[model samples]
Target chain A: MPNYPKGERRRAEILEAAFDAFGTVGYRNASMVQIAADCGVSRAGLLHHFPTKESLLEAVLKQRDRIDNEQFFAGGTSDDGLDYLTRMVRLVEHNAAHPGIVSLFAVLSSEASDPGHPAHVYFQERYARSRSWLRRAFRDLEQRGMLRPHVQPDGLDVEFLSLLDGLQVQWLLQPDAVDMPARVRAFLSRVLTEVA
Target chain B: MPNYPKGERRRAEILEAAFDAFGTVGYRNASMVQIAADCGVSRAGLLHHFPTKESLLEAVLKQRDRIDNEQFFAGGTSDDGLDYLTRMVRLVEHNAAHPGIVSLFAVLSSEASDPGHPAHVYFQERYARSRSWLRRAFRDLEQRGMLRPHVQPDGLDVEFLSLLDGLQVQWLLQPDAVDMPARVRAFLSRVLTEVA
Candidate 1:
């Protein structure tokens, strides 16, 4: 039999419910009651697990951060980051399949500017870490002679990270307009080509 | 002497104040009282120019949009967009100079997604129009054989538009780590190379 704790299973269920509720109604508009109802738990029981509405929101956000890192941000690519590009494109494709979570991040990322907001720190750290990690990956790629010779701005890492982020906003807003996978492939192919 | 009317000057002054207030405090946290103080007008006077908070907010957004479009969004290489790449680089540089307005858009674009929200329709149309403009521009480029022959998913316009939107989010979050203008320029250069 599976050894997962019953409480842990219930907590996961509550977080999933929160994700769905926030996806539909957004963070500010979604009620704790609806989330608890979705989980088939009493409001008090949900509170026992999350303590506060803000905590529940934070937990959901943390869950997404974990998944994003695991999927796109965790690994490195040697051959001009084509693998990373593919992973990122697939990540976007997955995000489109489960758009509720994407909406949650869109809503929370905007509101997270309030330093006291629960998600403020998470997003702040996320942007910082994502930029740094992607920078390192690009550096490793450049050192392997994948990038065109004498590219500036300390490497193409900053541009790559920005383009990755910028493409997500466009894809989320107008999926029909952009095939995220192809766009990444096109840019990487041009920039990451071996010196002939 | 400058021959502007009291009403015209007051309207202009209110917009200026609204820009500063909204830019600093964001759409939600900014107040009419603060806007009135900034313009040296009575709260009642401000309302006479703009009947409601929503009206004022919309007007402010419109003005900022106008400035951005005139200054940045209109960056086509020719009327047919030969200079679109260079023009977009200019836009990013301009945005970096006026981060206050950029921050306002970042906050409001997401807030404006509430169906009934003041800027909701504006953002919806804005995204559509921006993407459309880019697509048409790229279509022209493709027709003229300016872009690579095999560009797909409606060619470079869709991806170009997405990159601009996506880069803005990262630039807003991390100004130093991601040099917005430089990164955007590098990205444009890589994707738009005509190395024939």
Candidate 2:
């Protein structure tokens, strides 16, 4: 039989190379051939693993999400709204330590806004899913009467997600000027009566 | 006078074409030759006006800034904190009608986060200037005793700008789901006692 373990290892290596390349130069500018060279694989071998740049991008994005979900839901998905938000702040703090992860999401999500982009549908659905999750958290807060009177439930999901996404770009550009966790906590404080 | 007016017209046409391409496909994927063709100019002719892709990007960015400033400061730079925020909401309203501008900023700003990107310094300084301007507004509100008690002064500028920048990506992805101006107004209401 073929060496399954070796094949998986090689695939992971290619993904690591692509993740870094996409984060650094962006998806459009990152070349598959260069990514192959970076990972000590032939172009054909890289294609064998990824099939295409879009496929490679998809794999990288999925990997990022897996890591993020693991970190954010380390306790296996807390239903407590305050606990959820506390986890979000910790996640943002985690992101601050890893600029590469922040850069990848910022670059890809913005690039994917073009209707013709390969990842266009992916990001659209991703944001929808994110909003739904946040909606649950906000609903929990509302039931507990923790949501501030001024905070409208209608657009809070979009606003909170936007705040998180937008903070990444600013933090990437000027890390010294932006404290991502602090900003996120500040926003949470304004929206919720008890931040936890 | 070698047809100076005609040359200026040609330059404007090129700028418009480049703007659309950059917004749609982003800077890295947009082909210079395609942009020239879109504007009905020869590649060499396009180069005569903008010697390089980076130069064209700079011109397009400057034009965007000029338009934004004109729209935001139509009243000659309002020092009134509430008036400034009202103008900002109006600007977000203006942006909703023009998706191209929003796309361009969202795509470029995130892409420009890479330190090696040509517009890296431009966006870095732009955000700095933005934060400084926001700082002035928050300071004015503080002086007027209109700032909320919970609003921390340290990173409000970054948080507000992050919200605006972050909202654009979501709006561009799902326009019907995001009311950019309303979200901006809502966030402002939380920070300021009176949003005007």
Candidate 3:
């Protein structure tokens, strides 16, 4: 078995609690004391793990990305872009099972638009990475003639991401009314149809 | 000559300054004192016009709606759904000129997802109204045989709004990189294509 450091474990515990608090009450309203209480750690103990709220939030967002990457991008090394999109659908399906995390992300991303917001730089980098990845994936699909003839693969990347983000917001607002996974699947299938 | 009450003028000035401050710093980080200073008023003086942060936010949001409605839906009472969409494009084009307001709105709407968030109810009602308006407009287009046969007019409403909002976020993040209005127009054109 791989060695597990006690400090690392404590850090993980703090992050989980932070995510819960931030997701439920929002970043601005969530206090560090509350997060520490949630994690069963003294305020000083939590501070040892993360000295600042911004640092704690950054760690939480990174942890989220690591989990998402592991869960959704594990087999994305395959050359098939369609398969990659299928993985994206799976990720959305997974998101449906975890509404709190989705809400946290949606809320943070929007809040991060303000240049002074703590997550603003983090989100900027995140979007840059995501957009470039999708652009590369779509370009690969185009090379194989999988994308529709009229579709500019790179241009569609922005729209695809937008739909994903937008759908999540709608689903969060009205879970029962918005069947997010179904809508995404249908939309993707239509967009990916091979043109004669 | 039209009469302009001093209180009404001051209220409008406060709102404009508030909108600017909130847009720059985001709702959470923006200070009432700064907004009052921007409007050449004291904190208590500003509070005389709007009592609380939440109340001020609500008023700013309402003012945004009034401006948007006046600008985009001014002449949208006709039977053609395409015309309404054209108006939406115009609104987006207009939004491009005001990145601060767009950023403020995007951030706040996401922040409002938490049930207890002050603007939560406001966003909920705003979304419901927007969706319903689009649904009605799309239904009319379908009745007029304008929508593509494969297009479910009612269903497209959410996706349409999603694209609008999603694109706005992306545009705000990379103002020079994302051509939101053009992308929206292209997407709408594709969706509204008449089936042969």
Best candidate, lDDT-wise?
Answer: 2
Error of 2 at B185 (Å): 0.6
In candidate 1, what are the lDDT values of residues A1-196, reduced to their tens digit?
2466988888999999998766544566568888889889988889899989989888888798788777765565444444655666677667766656666776566556545556676777887776666566566667777666535436365555555555555555556665666666666665655311
Q: List interface RMSDs for the candidates, in order.
A: 3.7, 1.0, 2.1
lDDT of 3 by residue, A142-168 (tens): 788776555555467788788888887
RMSD of 3: 3.2
Backbone collisions counted per model: 4, 0, 0
Kindly list the per-residue Cα lDDT of model 2 for residues A19-118, writing each as its tens digit.
Answer: 9998977788799999999999998899888898989988999999998998888878768878988998999989899999999999999988888888
lDDT of 3 by residue, B1-196 (tens): 1366988888888999988876665576678888998889888889999999988998999888888888876764665667777788889899999887687777777766777778777877777888887888778777777765555554577787787778877887777667888778666655666421
Tell me, by DockQ, which candidate is best.
2
Candidates' lDDT values, in order? 0.67, 0.90, 0.77
Candidate 3 chain A, run of 10 with poorest lDDT = A187-196
DockQ of 2: 0.83
lDDT by residue (B1-196, candidate 1, tens digit) is 2578999999999988887766544566678888999889998899899988889888988898888779865533365655665676777788888877776776666555456566776877887787777777666666776764433425466556656655666666656666766666665555443521
Ranking the candidates on TM-score from highest down gives: 2, 3, 1
